[model samples]
Target chain A: MPIIAAQGLTMRFPRVTALDRLDVSVEAGVVGLVGANGAGKSTLIKILLGLLPPTEGRASVLGLDIAREGAAIRERVGFMPEYDCLPPDVSATEFVVHMARMCGLPPPAARERAADVLRHVGLYEERYRPIGGYSTGMKQKVKLAQALVHDPQLVFLDEPTNGLDPAGRDEMLALIRRIGSEFGISVLVTSHLLGELERVCDHVVIIDGGKLLRSQAVESFTAVSGVLTVEVQDGRDALGEHLHAQGVAVRPEGRVLVVDIAGERTYDLIRDGVADLGLHLVRLEQRRHHIEDVFTS
Target chain B: MSTSTIHDIGYRRYDGPRLGRGYLVRSLYVHNVRAVWGLGRPARAKVMPFLLAAVMVAPAFMDVGAVLLTDRAEVLMRYSAYAIYLQVVVSIFVASQAPVLASRELRFHVVPLYFSRPIAPLPFVLAKFAAMVTALLTMTAVPVVVLYVGGLIAKVPHPLTHLREFLLALVGCALFALVIGALGMAVAVLTPRRGFGVAAVIAVFLLSSAVVLLVQNIAEFRTNFSLAGNAGYFAPFNLVDIVQVRLLGAERTAEAVPDGFISGVLALLLCAALVGGAVAVLYRRFRKAGLS
Candidate 1:
């Protein structure tokens, strides 16, 4: 069953409608919510978390109604917010342990679980240091640690890679992927950058202007489009002309030629054309569709 | 010849039973209580509360010494008048620490983290309210306890009377804590900035008292009968004092409100109103703040 299901959920802020009748059901996996800023990604997550009541329609997380069962749902789900929400005065261990206790762990269990989760999130001795003295990456790790300390069945990571350098982003993404794959924990991770989600998400949901643009498995999302990218060793200009002469829609994209796939014969035509011109065909492959293509196409 | 691998401390799911909502409230209460006194915070955070508490307790010790040295009961400050006497220190305590309890969460945007858990917004707010009240109670009651013990240690005559008065002073202290705590928390929630919250809490007390005193003095000088006695109602501290004097049967020292059964009822009603109004404001503020 889908872990989170929303039916025409709409959230109207004072000035803008953050979610406009957004209907999407997220299955249990590493699901990526891809959208631009103000594209209703955070709004949908807030509604699912029962933090904000939707202006219209209904939603559910873990099969529990968001309106009536928010507390119960929150008991089972964890959230790592996009912005900083930790107390700088407290140490990471103290904060996470407190969060674990807030999630209903007894004192000793809370402390033990906090330590384990902090370790999982790659925080070491610095976990005892005040968060005020830590780097942004360390603070983010603490936020992640607190979210996971409760051992929630599902986790909502909102821009988890935000404010991180490249290596930090990679580490965070790897951690998120492991959370889904190894631990069997459902993850609904949001990012504006499509490439990051493409690496970790089993499924991708693209949103734009507070509306669902596309939702599909990650494999289907990057499935081959009806276009082939052809790269020749030399005479790239000649290759474009040759493909054009064959009544094919072809355009030069840098060192390669992008040809519209007319049918199965398009591949054969490209092959025969390459032979006819005596030019070395360095690469010929079906162009993979990107999540950004959902918006552009 | 040794094969020792690094301990694999990767992610592990907690299948342990989750406790109920009461735990959330209790944990928040404990955390906020510690936060109020800066127990787990930096040493610098400890200075203001401890300093004020020490200053408050020192007077009681000195009062006992004076009683001992002079062999007179006149040196003893009245039990019920303790809060009124140390009103400035108490107000500073409230003003300085209420923000730590009420405003710091909002300032750091950590409120959303709390609401995202099983904890509801009302309980979260109530926990903060309870913590501030406890902190205020400690600040007020510790000195009262000191005075009571010192009075007994000095062997003041009518020991039973001193104990009874001490008990009554504790009741008065509780009322003071509730009223001041409510007002401080209500003011602190208006802004997320600690400095602004502190300034606003102080202004609510000091400004109201200053205005009421100015008005009272003017009315007395100008022979305005209506404003002379009733002006004390304008300040929360003075209103609390009026309650301590009339309803609690404590002797009126500073406030000049006329003594009557109706005055006692009015003071009680106003105390209830202040507390109720503060809770109402906080509930409304937190309803919006839960998501903010």
Candidate 2:
């Protein structure tokens, strides 16, 4: 069964329709929900977690009815919120251990698990220090740690890297990637930055104004630009001419040749042509369309 | 990959009203840790009632010797209601904030994080009340010990009187907190905004007190104050005055301790009704928030 499935989900807020008629299904991998603020990413996550009552439609997580078995579902899932919420005076070790206990872990087990998860999230040495005293990066780590302490099956991270600096963002991202890959936890992570999600997410779901724009694997997310930039050390103009002579559109892009091979057999043609030219092809890469294309469209 | 693997890390048991103990206790821990000397990251959060007690009571310790030497020592030596006093405040604050609690969690980004797992919305509300009560209960003890010990050092007379007050104070404090807590929580569940809920609560408190007195004062009865069960409704708010009447055993007021006891019971029932309503509303709101 799919880990999560939603059919015609809708959520209405006082000010805006936070989620429209959206449909989604997931089968256990790190899926990134990419959207701007108020795009209904948080709303969708809540519905799956059985936190929000949808205005319309039905949803299920881990093969359970989201409406009826919400508590059952939540017990198995983990969540890292976007804002700073850890108590300033409490140590990360104490907070996470407490969370683990709440998740039904016995005292000894909760402590052991809390310690392990905090260490895993990169708060190893500083776990003993009060979370309030910790840096932003450290606080983020504690949040992540508490979510993982109970060994949940899936984790929903709402803009996990929201307020961090560039370096902190990268570290948080790395930890997220590890959560999905190393810890074997399925993640439904959301972010405004599509590029960041692209690097780590196995699958991507894009939304705008609470509506789905596209949902596809990372491979399908990247669109092939019209022009493939080709570079050769000795034959640049000659290569452009050779390709042009063969009815392939080729334009000189400085020292490289931008070729238009718009066919499934383009790779074959490029290979054969390069072998025929008696020249080394240093670079033969298709220009990737930026994520902004989806927004612009 | 395997079905067994899925079940290993999943929530398969489906049941009704499985209260989430984790969230209930964790909420308390969060409140406790947050308020206990202001210890976590979200540093700006106050844990208000805890701080309030410390601020209100700390200065009283400085003049312990002087107070012991004076006649006013009786009030200080009356009883250790430190726990009761703190609990009352905590209960009041908790009740006042209930309506705003759900909204705050949503606003502060804690709701989604809280929801992502098998956490039910009802637990958060219940847990919050419990946390506030427990936190209030925990902090109330410190001041009692401080005051009690301070009295000894100062050699105050009738130390037993203070101990009696302390004992009664626990009962008084619990009744006070529970009564106010139930009402505040109900109001909190009904409201959405923190400020609105808080303001509403303050208004309720001020208004309730005014109305209670207004009714008592203006009513042309055979007598204004009654020592019977009919007078039970007004006892909690009028506790100090009731204590003055009952303990002093005046002729006009009932000389029986049972009269005082009955009043406490009736007030407790009122609190229960309010708290029960508050919990029910929030729980429903939580379910709606979680499931469509």
TM-scores for candidates 1 onward, in order:
0.93, 0.67
Question: What lDDT does candidate 1 reach at residue B1?
Answer: 9
* Candidate topping DockQ: 1
DockQ for the candidates, in order: 0.52, 0.22
User: Which stretches of candidate 1 lie above 4 Å from their native place?
Assistant: A13-15, A239-250, A259-282, B1-7, B217-227
Scored by CA lDDT, what does every candidate get? 0.86, 0.65
Q: Which stretches of candidate 2 lie over 4 Å from their true place?
A: A208-211, A221-227, A232-246, A252-256, A262-282, A286-297, B1-112, B115-119, B130-170, B180-236, B239-292
Query: What fraction of the genuine interface contacts, i.e. the true contacts, does candidate 1 reproduce?
Result: 0.78
Q: Write the per-residue lDDT of candidate 1 for residues A6-123, one digit (tens) a residue.
A: 8998889899989898889889999999999989887788889988889999999999999999989999999999998988998998899999999999999999998888877888
> DockQ for the candidate 2 complex?
0.22
Residues B1-292, model 1: lDDT tens digits: 0001112655567778788878778888999898888888789999999999898888888888888888787678888888778888888999999888777877788888888898877888888899999988888898888777777777888988888888888988998899999999999888668888889999999899888878878887898846766887778778877777777777875546655767767977888888888888787777676686
Q: Residue A280 in candidate 2 has what lDDT?
A: 94
RMSD of 1: 3.0
